[model samples]
Target: MSKVFLSAKLPAATTKILTDHGLTVSVYAGEGLISHAELLKSVVDVDYLITPLSTQVDAAVIDAAPKLKLIANFGAGFNNIDAAYAKTKGIQVTNTPAVSTNSVAEVTVGLMLALSHRIVEGDAQMRTSGFPGWAPLYFLGSEIAGKTLGIVGFGNIGREVARKARALAVNVQYWQPHRLTDPEERSLGVQYVEFADLVQTSDFISINAPQKPDNHHQFSAAVFKEMKATAFLINVGRGPIVDEAALLTALQQGVIGGAALDVYEHEPQVTAGLEKLNNVILTPHIGNATVEARAAMGTIVANNVVLLEQGHNAKFIVNA
Candidate 1:
């Protein structure tokens, strides 16, 4: 029987699937971030390894696992994994893409609506019993109907967001490295625009791009300045894509109306200044955190391991 090491706790269903295949599984005992020494000790003799986004799979770590054949990531983003280094050692990598698309897309739309309508402010005021009565001038906010939405990356999640936005009567535009043909544009009902044009003219801008060297700090002070004063920004992608200091300055200086973020540069340790600002909406990286999404991701990870153990190609192999 082959041995597998799981870095984090997964859904019971996923564990059952793997155990039913007659494979030995060992789960790490600790929660939160696992130490490097702990990982090095645990993965020494395992044939397969399953990990989450928080775990870093670097060259040294991969080299330590002499018997390792496959690595299965629980999330769509594989930035934490050093793919190039892993390839050198003939280790296969796989991620569950499009498994949590709807869940994340729903969160993106929710953030946009919350920022545009000031939903959080209203909720806070009501909790404090400060709401006097309904008045014509009370809590005026931006309307979502008939506004232009610009998506930074047009992948599965981005496309789903556009579908929902169109249902609410919003025009959709997108900017990506690879251009979409006219037929593809017609099918998605989205226009391919230049990066500068998307930044300048969009009423609401949502980022779904992956984190790469070329895209790091893609939205800085200069990009913020190009946007209209009434425009709003929402990010459900990697945090470092937007410069934290620059975003803070933009919010304080009113470069744009407001901002919403589901991910941050230094996660779980937001800057003090960001906490003090009332114009921004923040969440604790819960875009694909729904119960359903987590279960689906776990199942995908388990299946990937099973396939490799059975001498078959994994369904979502990254290296292939």
Candidate 2:
């Protein structure tokens, strides 16, 4: 039986599958995130490593695990893992993609609605008894109907968001490196525009792009300035894609209306300035945290490890 190091606690279903397969699963059993030193100690002499996006499985950590054959990530984003280095060591890397797409897309849309309608502000006012009386023009907000929704990256999750927005009667536009054909665009009810045009024309921008070298700091002060003053931004994708400092300035200077972020640039340690803004809706990177989504992701991770150990192809191999 192969030895598996479960860096983060997984669902009971995942644990059963690994144990049923006769793999010796060693869990950290810690209350919070496992530290680098702890992870190094846990992964030593382990045949497989199952971890989350928060875990940093870098070269140093990998070097400590001489027996590691596979690194199974709990989510779609493997930005936390060093894929190139893992490949060099003849170690397979896998991510659980497609499992949490709809759940995350739904959260992105929910954030957009909350920001557009000022739901958080209304709740705060009601809680503090600030709503003395209702007026005809009280708590004015923009409607989602007939508004242009520009998606930065049109991947599976982005496409799912578009479909949901269309059901709400929204005009969808997308910008990616590769342009879709006219027929494909018609089917998705989206048009591919240049990055600058998407920023300038979109009434609401939802970022669903991956975090890559070219996309780092993609939304800077210049990009924010290009947007319409009434436009809102929503990010359900990776953090560092948007410059937090630039986003703060945009909200402060009224360059853009507001933003709803599920992920942040620094993550877990959001900038102090952003916390002061009531116009922004922030979540601690819980986009794909639904019970169903987490279970599905965990199952995928477990199956990937099993497949790799059995010398079969995993469902979503990052190195491939």
Instruction: Please give the lDDT score at residue 149 for candidate 1.
Output: 95
Q: What is the model-wide C-alpha lDDT for candidate 1?
A: 0.90
TM-score of 1: 0.96
lDDT: worst 10-residue window of model 2: 267-276
Clashing residue pairs for model 1? none
User: Which residue pairs come into collision in candidate 2?
Assistant: none
Tell me the tens digit of each residue's lDDT in model 2 across 170-272: 9999999999889989998888899999999999999998899999999999999899999999988888999999999999999999999889888867877
Candidate 1 structure quality by residue, lDDT tens digits, 71-156:
89989988888877788888899998998999999999998889889998788788887889999998989879889999999999
Show model 1 residue runs off by greater than 4 Å: none
Model 2 ranges with Cα > 4 A deviation: none
lDDT of 2 at 207: 95
